[model samples]
Target: MRTLRASVLARFSARASSTLAFDSTSHLDSLQHTRIQDLRSALFKGGAPSRIWAHYTNILNYFNYDVLPLELHQQVLRQCSPPVRSVRLSDAKRLAQGKRLEHRHLHEGRFQAIISNIRALGCTPSLDDYHFILEHFAAVGYHVGCHQVYQEIIHLGLTPQTKTFGLCLQAIAHRLTLPTFEVFRMRLVSQTRKALDDLMSDMRRFNVPFTTANLDLALRIFKETVDEEGLNKLVKWTYGIDLDNPDCSPLDLLENQTTSSPQPFSTHALNTIIDTLGRFGDISKVVQAFEVLSQPLPQAKQYRFSSFDDEDDFGVPVHVPSPSNHSLPYALPNTTTYSMLLRHISRARHSTLARHYLIQAFKLDRQ
Candidate 1:
């Protein structure tokens, strides 16, 4: 998902989008293509803003304003804008102390300038273009900007894609979880719930299965809001299960439901479930999940060229028509898994249980 990729990349300094939008760039010649790419790279690779802006003029002249695809306009606007790095409270405070424009305002100005840049390029902003900026706003911790851009998209009657909701939801979750936001907790809590619910509902209209990244973001939104009802609502939405199924627990919904999304199994998802259970003082469920993780991964014989033990697709020896003894290999728990469990056990302050997990982790790690 575009939303997922953007969120992950936000941790690092912002760079140009390597991916292009769903449009026609095929008409452009190789020279034109390479020039656009060079401009994109130069945007963040270190250069003066004035020179970058000038390069934009050269591109326009080079194309002679012929066949300016929406993607080119979008990338130009997207790249020419400033980098969206993490904004700390300290940074905000530092900006407030200055008489110049605020830090966030500087961010706002660049975005507005890019919109003007789009018009200068004789291109109307497409839905994908707006989504790019919305994602950008979300990345820089400006939930309000994300909401405003989203509203404009709706007002323009542009039907949003799934990534649209993902960006807004992720923005809300990221902003609300900040320590600085705690003071306004009571006022924002109810509003956040309604807005989040609305976003989810809007996303469902597309009738597409949520990507695992989006689902993970939803999990975070529910957790931060502490909405048990919403948690069950997510379970109902993803899987056909609800509170009516008393035997079913949220942990069961931890799996990636749609094959179109993340991997079938994620140790991260498992760890989150384990951590949630521990938070609820549900020690039994935590232990159950841990035991499942602790189970020995199935082993199989490794290939040995000297013995001619390698097998073909049908599991027959390549050199001979004999059945291969090797079995399918599986992934085992990694250091991260063991580290999460160890911390969880340590928090409960159960020395014997902690010792057991540590010893098991020690033995379980092949590395």
Candidate 2:
């Protein structure tokens, strides 16, 4: 039994020595030194994830390792330096206090750098991370940044949630749309209109919730393009109203509460409808739109109306239409509403109707 144990111990010692000799003689030390040098080169670059990743690849190649350890990968990512424009908490607070325009640019650059670094490190950003970037771009009205983030999210094999999808639509719309100018009008107005319609259709296809803001975006497109057919369909979906139905007036749609609760229309929405009608519809259509705006909303909801707090030198308060109180049981027509009505009346070449509305507008303003 002692001879057997001695034999086993000798075999173990011989195997260990052979392993050590192979490691010493087979360029293992040189390979290790190369890896250390690569790591140092990567780290000394001051936090560039791509450079670090490349260095890591070199180390793997030298060692004939297919992949780095996950722990080491993460360590390299954590050590990477953030971009210079990334605002610290205190710097952000200061920027917020000052309300500088550059804040948006700073945030945009930071998000870009973060996403690039994350990708360089082979890390997949989650939905929440992508949403944060998208929302920031949307808030800042930087449609280009929004699109860049959106494309990256798609490329990452991730599905966009409802809000992300909505933001993408908004970003695309903002990019395609240009401010209307009298001197140099945009030539792509028709193309933009088509794109907007397609986006709205996509929203419906995806079953995105029809929030007020989303509806407003759709409505704005309809108004801009004078797509009355589209507007009617939108109204039918949003408020369950069919304007063509013989029994229902536009005001009736707002008044009848027997069905599901109608989403309240903003004064801006009312104005948009009136404006659209003024541009394309006949005299009767404009009149119908005006009457709807003139109707007072339920007293409970009246406070939704925005007040013009400014007073004349005589202390006479301006009685403008409340912005939110488009429906009424006491809705007043705002200047915009009156202007739309008058413009249409004049366009129809109806002198008597124009005069009538003008006089009524003056009376309402005085009140």
Candidate 3:
């Protein structure tokens, strides 16, 4: 009886699939107009939303249905307004599986379909939606996909938050192609720099606030892509650290800006910027960045530091949390920071200075 039941269920599933296929084909062949109302009603009549979406995409391709277009996919979403939670979850799962399977193109095709569906529903995609799409493209080095999502956010009049902006910078960075020939390298680098400039201009237009994350990502992008001019521009903006101007110093910016509002710096951003400057053998700028990094973060939340003074655990060895855990404004130099400084000194052939930094690093660790 159990074997018979299983057989019957399998037959029923196959029959249902065949019946739906036949109906979809007939509808497509019979109608030149292919009204969206009918399309939506037909596609969603049987299966779950995700299944329906996947099936319909395959059906459209199978029939070579040009009349339907991408907009039809959107129309189904707008008319039905199927809960996107499951669809998005499924998308993430597929992407993860695709990565393991080495099928990036297939993953992107599905993602494009998902985006079309989101747009079709006449619903403004949230920051999370945009971020997910951007990440998919960014991970695969699909720079065009990243730009499309960025444009869609702007079209919806949504300002990308700092994290989103950082992702955008990273996506642009991935477009960079390093060439062995100097001529090709120059051309490629120039184009990338222009693209980056345009992205920054868009950020300004959208009123996206420049934060430590943004600055750090931008600096890393420039460093990786070998865009010295871009790096210089970033340094000047973040800390007024310009190599061409020997007189320029962090102290000058801090003291002069006391009369104005000084921009708050993050230790991570300072570390990355200093590390990059050090790579270029700019000892003075590296030192300046360290000075800034070591200073107390004036803009940090005061309540966080206030807890440090509380006497609730008097004589008890107080457990101090790292910057990430405690919400402190600045972080002390970790091992990586000292390593960068040592590398900088060594690269400049200053064995004496490198040894000095190495010893300092060890002492700090012991303390």
> Cα lDDT of all candidates, in order?
0.61, 0.60, 0.60
Q: In model 3, what lDDT does residue 19 have?
A: 100
Arrange candidates by lDDT, descending: 1, 2, 3
Compare the candidates by TM-score and give the number of the best one: 3
| TM-score versus the correct structure, for each prediction | 0.52, 0.50, 0.53
Query: Which pairs in model 2 have colliding backbones?
Result: 47-81, 296-328, 296-329, 296-330, 296-331, 297-327, 297-328, 306-323
Report the candidate with higher lDDT, 1 versus 3: 1
Candidate 2 C-alpha lDDT tens digits along 223-262: 6667677778777666554545412434544555324445
- TM-score-based ranking: 3, 1, 2
Name the better of 1 and 2 by lDDT.
1
Model 2 regions lying over 4 Å from their true place: 1-125, 132-162, 176-191, 245-261, 281-283, 296-332
Off by over 4 Å in 3: 1-54, 58-132, 148-164, 173-191, 236-264, 291-331
lDDT of 1 by residue, 308-349 (tens): 356776778666433233221112456776676677778878
How do the residues 230-261 of candidate 3 rate in per-residue lDDT, one tens digit apiece? 77765655555554552334444534542222
